[model samples]
Target: MRILVVEDDAGIALGLRTNLQQRGYAVDVCASLASAWAALSSEPFDLVLLDLGLADGDGGDLLLRLRQARAAAPGALPDPLTPVLIMTARDQVADRISGLNLGADDYLVKPFDLDELEARMRALLRRAAGRAHPLLVHGELVVDPAARTVLRAGEAVELAPREFALLLLLLESRGRVLSRQQLEARLYNWQDAVGSNAVEVHVHHLRRKLGEGLIQTLRGVGYFIPREDGA
Candidate 1:
């Protein structure tokens, strides 16, 4: 999954980025609210790790802006229902309630355990994906998002990080087509040099590992996985 970390503390941001990356998540870190806004506006992040105290302004403002974008016209923000996890040193009850009221999925106080953060993130992601369980099943394919494991016909299938991410996205949007631009935004950050055929390469690898019929490409359009009725 792709996660954006908005933290002003250099140490905290570095730690978050490193730990999340090691856990097989694409992470982007920014110190100021302006940078965070730019990143959120440009990319389709699966989740956001926000710190209330930012260099430029309170993260609450950014959270409000995110909600506003979601309430705007269609396509105003990629993934309008994206989850936000607020992390800050403020541990007061009012602070937590305020953040949650502002539409944050979870609130984490500073000096928290990384394991706990990850667990909360997983819960939010599952909720956002409309998944009651960590395991997502479609036909003979079973994907354990938390474990980052895929099983087909009761057999395990190993996949690279990018490949796994791509499959997960497709699974989440099983009946809908995802355009190339949307896939690119979800798969890559601004700093990454995305090749013209990056998504195509990942899709090809996933198909080879899963099945050729798993992902269908629309001519001159996008890609999608057929629903159960094969519509």
Candidate 2:
């Protein structure tokens, strides 16, 4: 998934960007509130990791603006229900309450373990996908997004990080076709040097590992995984 990290702490931002990328997520970091707002207005992010304290403006203010924009005109923003998780040094009861009331989906105090942070992120992503359980079933394939494991016919299947991400995205949009541009935007961050056929290469890798017919192409349109009825 693509995530926007709004933080000013250079060390913390670098650590988060590195860790999230290693875990198979496309992440973009913004140091100030202005940059964050600009980023949000430009692209679609599956989730946002926001810091409360900002040098230019308060993160709460940005959160309020986002929610208000969604409420007033949902189409103006990339997603009306874009999830936000606040990570801040504020640990007071009121601060937490205020953040939650301002549209933060989840809150985590600073000085947190990366493991726990990843777990929470998984939970939030699952919730956003409307999945009560972590496992995703497609025919004989069972995918554990949290564990980053895949089982086909009860046998383990190992996939590269990019391949796994592409599979997950295809599964999530089972009946819909995703253009190569959409896939590229969701799979790669700004820093990654992408080849012209990067998405095609990833899709080719997935087809080889999973199955030939698992992912279908539209010739001139895009790619999609067919529904059980083959629609």
Estimate, for each residue in 78-133, the C-alpha lDDT of model 2 and write its tens digit.
46588899999999999999999999999999989999998888888888877888
Instruction: Quote the positional error of residue 54 for candidate 1 in Å.
Output: 1.4
What are the runs in model 1 whose C-alpha is more than 4 Å off?
A: 70-72, 78-80
lDDT value, residue 120 of candidate 2: 88
lDDT of 1 by residue, 190-228 (tens): 567999999999999999999999999988889999888
- Location of the lowest summed lDDT over 10 successive residues in candidate 1: 70-79
lDDT of each: 0.87, 0.89
List clash counts for every candidate, in order. 0, 0
